[model samples]
Target: MQNFDYCTPTRLLFGQGVVEKLPEVMSRYGKKILLTYGGGSIKKMGLYDMVKELLKEFTIVELSGIQPNPKYDPSVLEGVKLCKENDIDVILSVGGGSVLDCSKAIAAGAKYDGDPWDLISYKVKAQAALPIVDIITLAATGSEYDCGGVISRTATNDKIGYVDPLLYPVVSFLDPTYTFTVSAKQTAAGCADAMNHIMEQYFCEDSTILNDGFMEAGLKSLMVNAKKCIEDPEDYTARAEMMLTCTYGCNGIYSLGNSPTGWPLHGMEHVLSAYYDITHGVGLAIITPRWMKHVLSEKTVDRFVKYGVHVFGIDSHQDPFTIANQAIEATYKFFESIHIPMHLKEVGIDESRIDEMAKHVADNEGLENAWVPLLRQDIAEIFRASL
Candidate 1:
C-alpha cells in the first residue's frame, strides 16, 4: 500500500426528511445566504418552497439556471459578483453536482479580487473561501464530498478539474428522496459515472487488497441497484444505495493508499465534453471500455484479469489476455445494457474533431503521464475506437 493523507470534513445529514434540518444547519453560517440551483427542478419538486419556508428568518439571494458541465463566464462570475455585492456569508447549493461545483468555484472566487478563471485554471491558488452547504438531488460527480469540481470555459472549449482543499463543502444534506424523481437516462448515466470512479482507482498500479475489494463491491452494488432504479424510480432502497455510492465516488476514500492512475478516462472525456457539451457521464461510459481495450497489454493484463474475475465474475481459468478482453467487453455491454449510447457517433461526435480533441487532451490533461502513458496518437486511436 502507498502512503497517504485523507480527511473529509463535510457533515452529512443523510436519510429521509433530512432537509428539514436545513434551518438549524444554516443558522451556523449566518443570515446572508447565496442560494444556487440549476434550472427550476427544485421549484417543480416543491423543495424550493420547503426550503424557503424553513429559512424564512434568513435573507436569501438567488443564483439559478446553473447548467451541467458548469460554465465559468456567467455562473461563476455572476456568483462571485452576487457574493461580493451581498456580503454573502454562506452559499447554499440546492441541486445536483454541477450546482455545487459552481458554488465551490464561487466560494473560492468570492474571496479573490482576480477573475474566477485564475483560481479554476490554477493560475492562482486560493487562500481562503466562503463556507458552502449543499442539498444534493443527484447521484453523480460526488462534488458534495470532494474538493474538486470540473469547470468548463466555453470560449476555449476547455473543461478543467479544479481541486483545492478550500473548496470542500462545510455541510451536505443527502436525502435520497430528493433523487427519487431522477429520470431514467440520468439514473443510468449517474451509475456509469460512479462506477468509472471506482474503476479508475482499482486499475492503478499500487492498490491495497482491502481497497480493491471495497471498490469491487461498490461497482457490483451500483450495477445492480442502478438497474433497480431504472425499473422503478421509486425504489427507496435502490435510490439510497445509489446515492451513497456516488457520494463516495470522487472523495478519494475508496482509493486511499493507492497509487494514482491520473484518471486517464476522465482526462480524455473532459475534452469530449468540452468540445461537444455532451453529458459528462455518458461521455465517460463511451470512452471507458475503449480506453481499457487500448491500454491492455502484458503489464496491465493481470489487473484486468482480477477486474474480470472479481467484478464481472468472468471465468478465471482462461488465459490472461482473454480474461482481459472479456472484462472489457463486459464493461461495454453493461453500459450499453443501461441504455448509455456506447459510441461517440451516437452522441453526435464525429471524426472531424478527433485530432483536435486528442491534441488538446494530450497537451492539457497530460495523459502521457497516466498509468499507461498514452500519447496523442494513442488517445486519438481510443477516440476512433470509441466512435
Candidate 2:
C-alpha cells in the first residue's frame, strides 16, 4: 500500500429533516451569511422557505444563478463582490455542487485583495478564507466533502479544478429528501459523475486489494441505485445510498493509500464542458468508455479483468483481453442505459473543434504522465472514437 495522509473536518448532518439544525450550525460561523444557490430550484422545492424561516434571525445575502460547470466570471466575481460589500462572515450554499463550488471560490476570494483567478490558478495561495457550510441537493461532484471545485472561464474555454484544503466546508447538511425532486436526466448524470470519480482512482498503477474492493462495491452500488433513482425519483433508500456514495466519490477516501492515475478522463472531459458548455457528467460518460478502450493493453488488461469480474461479474475465466473489452463495453452500455448521450455529436459537439480541444487537453491537462500516458495524437484518436 502507498503512504497517505487524510483528514475530513466537515461535520455531516445526514438523514431526513436535518435542515432544522441549520441554525445551530450557522451560529458557529456568524450571523452574516452569504446564501448561494443555482436558479430557483430550492424555492420550487420549498427548501428556500424553510431555510429562510430557520435563519430569519441571521442577516442574509443572496447570490443566485450559479450555473453548472460553475463559471468563474459573474458567479465567482459577483459572489466575491457580495461578500466584500456585505462583509459576509460565512457562505451557506443551498444547491448542488456548482453552487457550493462557486461558494468555495467566493469564500477564498472574499479574503484576497488580488484577483481570485490568481488563487485559482495557483499563482498565489490563500492565507485565509470565509467559512463555508452547504446543504447539497445534488449527489454528484462530492464538493461538499472535498476541498476542491472546478471553475470554468467561458471566454478562454478553460475549466480548471481548483483545490485547496482551506476550502473544505465547515459543515454539510445532507437530507436526501432535498434530492427527491431532481430530474431523471440530472439523477443519471450525477450517478455517472460519481462513478467516474471512483473509476479514476481504481484504474491507477498501484493500489491495495482493500481500495479495489471499495471502488468495486461503489461502482456496483451506483449502477444499481442510479437505475432505481431513474425509475422512482423519491426512493429514499436508493437516493440516500446513492447520495452517500457520491459524497464519498471525490474526497480521496476511496483511493486512500492508492496511487494516483492523474484523473485522465476528467482531463479530457473538462475540455469538452469548457468548450461546448455541455453537462459535465454526460461528457465524462461519453469519454470514459472510449478512453478505457484506448488505454487497454497487456500492462492494463489485468486491472480491467478484475474490474469486469468484481464489478460487472464478468466470467473470470475469460481471456484477459476479452474481459477488458467486455468491461469497457459494459461501461458504455450502462451509460446508454441511463440515457446519457454516448457520443460527442449527440451533445452538439462536432468534428470542427476536436483537434483544437485535443491539443488543448494534451498541452494543459498533463496527460503525458497519466497511467496510460496519452500524447496529443492519442488524445485526438480518443476524441474521434468518442465521436
Candidate 3:
C-alpha cells in the first residue's frame, strides 16, 4: 500500500425520482441561481420544464448552450458574465457532465478576477467557488461526484483537466430513468468510459489488493450492465447499476488509500477530444487498449494478467505475455462488441495530426508519473497504432 489521503464531499441522491429533492438542495445554496444546461436535450426530454417548475421559488438566471468536452471560450466567459452580473449565489447544472463541468468552471471563475484559464492551467489556485447543486442526466463523466472538470481551449487545441476540492457539488441528483433515451452509441461509449476509468486506476504502479478488487468489480459491473442496457434500453435494473457504476468511476473512493496512477489514458484522450472535437468517452475507448498494448512489459504484464483473468475470464494457464496480449485484444473486442469504432480512422481521425497531438500530450500532460512513463515518440507510436 502507498501513502495517501482521500476525501469526497458530494452528497448523492440516487434512484428514480431523486430529482424531487432538487428544490431542497438548491435552497441551501441561496436564492439567486445560475441555471446551466447544454443544447436542447433537456427541453426535448421535458426535464427543463420539470426543473424550472421545481425551482420556481428561486430567482433563476439561465445560462444555456454548454457543449461536450465543455469549451472555455464563450461558454466559460458567458458563464462568468452571468455569475458576475446576476450576483448569482448558486449554480444549478441540469444536463450531462458537460454542463456540470462548465458550471464548475464558472463557479470558480466567478470568484476570481484572473482569467479562468489560469485556474485550469495551474497558474493560479482557486480561492472559492459558488456552491453547485446538480441534477445529472448522464452517467459517463462522473463530474457530478468529482471535484475536477476537463475544459477545452479551442484556440490552442488544449484540454486541461482542472481539479479543486472546493468545486465538489453540494448535492447531485442521479435518476437512471433520465438516461433511458440516450442513444445506443452514447450508452456504449459511456460504458467504455467507465471501464477505462477503472482500468486506469487498476493499472497503477503503486496499488493495493483492496483497490484492485474495487476496480475489477466496478469494471465487471459496467460490462455486464452495459450489455443489458444496450439490448433493452429501459431495463431499469441494468440501467440503475450502470448509472451507479459510472457515478463512482472517477471519484477517489475506489482507490482511497492508493497513490495516484496519473490517469494516462485520460491525459492522451484529452488531446484527441480537444483537437478533433470528438466525444470524450469515445476517444478514450479507442485509445485505452492501444495504450495498454504499447505500455505492457515485464513490469506491467502482471497487471494485464490480473485484469484479463478477473474481468474477462482469460485462461490463467497461458504464459504471462500471451495472457497480457489476449487481455489487450479482449479490451479492443469489448469496445467493438458494443459497436464502438476501435480505430481512429473509423472515427474520422486521420493520421496527419498524430505527431502534433503526440507532442502536445507529451509537453502538456503529466505523463512522467504514469505506471509506464511515456515519451513523445512513444505517444506518436501509440497514435499510429490507434490509427
Query: Per-model C-alpha lDDT, please?
Result: 0.94, 0.94, 0.89
What value of lDDT does candidate 2 attain over all alpha carbons?
Answer: 0.94
lDDT of 2 at 316: 90
Residue pairs with backbone atoms closer than 3 Å in model 3 (clashes)? none
Per-residue lDDT of candidate 2, residues 116-217 (tens digit): 999988999999999999999999989999999999999899999999999999999999999999999999999999999999999988999898999999
Candidate 1: TM-score? 0.99
Q: Model 1, which residues run further than 4 Å from truth? A: none
Q: Tell me the lDDT of model 3 at 256.
A: 71
In candidate 3, what are the lDDT values of residues 1-387, reduced to their tens digit?
A: 766667889999989998988888888879999999998889999999999899899999998889988989999989999999999999999888889999999999999998988988889999999999988887788888899898998999989888999999989998999999888888998898888888877887677888888889999899888999999999999999998989898787778767677888999999998889888778998888889889888998998999999888999999999999998998889888999988888878999999999999999886877878888998899889898
Pull out the clashing pairs in model 2: none
Error of 1 at 25 (Å): 0.5
lDDT of 1 at 18: 92
- TM-scores of all candidate predictions against the true structure: 0.99, 0.99, 0.98
Lowest lDDT sum, 10 consecutive residues, model 2, at: 1-10
TM-score of 3: 0.98
Error of 1 at 267 (Å): 0.6
Error of 3 at 262 (Å): 1.8
